[model samples]
Target: MFLECQNINFRYPNGSMDVFHDLSFQMKTPGFHALFGPSGVGKTSLARIIVGDFNDYSGVVRSEGMQNLLYSYNLERLPDWSSVGKHLEKITPPSLRDRKNELIASFDMAETMRLRFSQLSLGQQNRVNLIRYLLQDFHLLIMDESLANVDERTREKIILGIKDMFPDTYFLYISHNVIEVSKFCREILVFRNSLKAPQVITVNGQDHKLGQTVSKDKLEQTMLEIMHAS
Candidate 1:
């Protein structure tokens, strides 16, 4: 598996309910994978846990040496005065320095490079952040409803473009939109609750060592059912 989590458990401080209880998941293929569930079902929490933002939880999250890149809409941690280029430089690996311009041009973000982080629109922020993360060598990408502000058309365009542009990279896209998942992901995971194992719906043919089977239409339908049920 490219990513695996076992016996994961967590709850907010001073909170009564456990957000996750022995919730486990494993991703065997390396492509675009979409995760969908109703709001506040630990979707964002899981992303934070996987990326090491939440350390209070107990479990084993093994990536097998694969580095992860996390992108989200909130940017309060970022310096408001810093330009997009400067921010990217701060996080970018030295080896990937040369690919900076190429990546910017690919995302059509050359102009935004000079703009301050505070000056860009939400969609522009997402594009710039995504490009910056992609320029570096990362094995896994976890996006937590990061492009919610961006319109459906633009989000689809950028996401599909990234999938086509980087065939080998693995993506875990967390979203509420089923149509978007149907269009982009080869595998879809639906979370009904934190206690039970999420429903796995594979769209494409088995492409990994741990091959499995499912259909796109079926996955979309299942996603809708789960969402409505929740």
Candidate 2:
């Protein structure tokens, strides 16, 4: 197993309501997955708990065959002192230079590489920051709306490229975009409304490949399942 969270129960300090109760989930293998639900449903909280950011919770959060978990969000910013290309080159291993170059091109960031981090738009900045993480060694990455401001077409390309290139890595993609998650992710753990039993529902997604087109019927079915679960 890659990860397991058994009987998780949590409430914030000085807060009135419990954020999660008897919440449990597991990732059986390394692949793309998602934590999805309406706002204030504790998606981010659960992610923090999984990454050991929140320790007050009562639960057994277990991970086997994995060394580290990294979290990335949309609001994270890179240093503005150096050019994006320079920053990437400084941190990337010499052996992975080819791969880094491939990602830059695949993300349609070849032109912006020479510009400073601050010069890029919000969407561009997110992509660059994500590239930095991608070059690093890690077992799992939790992306919390990390691709938020990017256009749909570009975001799709980046996602497909990442899935194709990092086939062995595990990803927990958190996003509000239902169509995107249903179309791209392998499995989605949808959180139900507050006070509901079985707070999380696991649904199989389309998991479309890099160059394949998913039929509308299949995509709609996944979306409907997610909607009903939510």
Candidate 3:
């Protein structure tokens, strides 16, 4: 397993509540995985747990080597707005740094490379945020709804591009789009009831359980319930 957790648990700083409850799962070394749930369900929190930023949690969350690299984008704060390309260059190597222009071209953000991150459209910045991690050669990738700011077209482009362009990099994607998740990932992990706690791999496919293969009506009901609850 590239990443695994056993009986993991966590709560906020206040002595009030727990975020996760005895969650456990193991991940293979490759392919894309999707995590879907309503907002604030600890999707981001789980990503934090995977990469080790969130130590407040109990239980064992473990990964090797590139785990931290996989999660550099779930930032505690936003990237500086001075320059998108420059921010990436600081962390990325000169070799990968040179590809910035080409990536910009591929993502249709060439015009914004020199512009301040604040100056670019939200979609453009989202592309840059994605590219930052995509450039790294990590064994696993843990992410949030980082693509939520972008349009549907760009989102699809990224889903396809990651598969085609970076086959070796493992992707752990999180999104609220159930239909898109079905298409974008080989497996889906559904966070029903709450983001914290043991997530249900509602459908199973590929080497892992994808997630619950709900009917269209049930899926819609799930989504509606999720929206209403959180």
lDDT rank order: 2, 1, 3
**Candidate 1 displacement at residue 77 in angstroms:** 6.3
Q: What ranges in model 2 sit over 4 Å off?
A: none
Q: Model 2 Cα RMSD, Å?
A: 1.1
lDDT of 3 by residue, 101-184 (tens): 566667777767677776766667677887877777667776677676778887776676666666666677888776666655
Worst ten in a row by lDDT for model 1? 201-210
lDDT comparing candidate 3 with the true structure: 0.65
Error of 2 at 45 (Å): 1.1
Task: State how far residue 118 of model 3 sits from its true place (Å).
Answer: 1.6
TM-score of each model, in listed order: 0.77, 0.97, 0.76
Query: How many residue pairs in model 2 have overlapping backbones?
Result: 0
Candidate 3: regions farther than 4 A off: 64-67, 72-82, 89-91, 97-99, 194-198, 205-230
Error of 1 at 125 (Å): 1.9
Give Cα-based local distance difference scores for all models: 0.70, 0.91, 0.65
Q: What is the lDDT of residue 168 in candidate 2?
A: 88
Stretches of candidate 1 off by over 4 Å are 68-78, 89-98, 195-230
User: Between prediction 2 and prediction 3, which has the larger TM-score?
Assistant: 2
1-230 in candidate 2: lDDT tens per residue? 48899999999999998899899888887788999998899999988998899999998999888787998888988798989999999999998999999999988899999999889999999999899889989899999998989999999999999999989889999999999999999999999855898989999999988879899999999999999998
Leading candidate by TM-score: 2
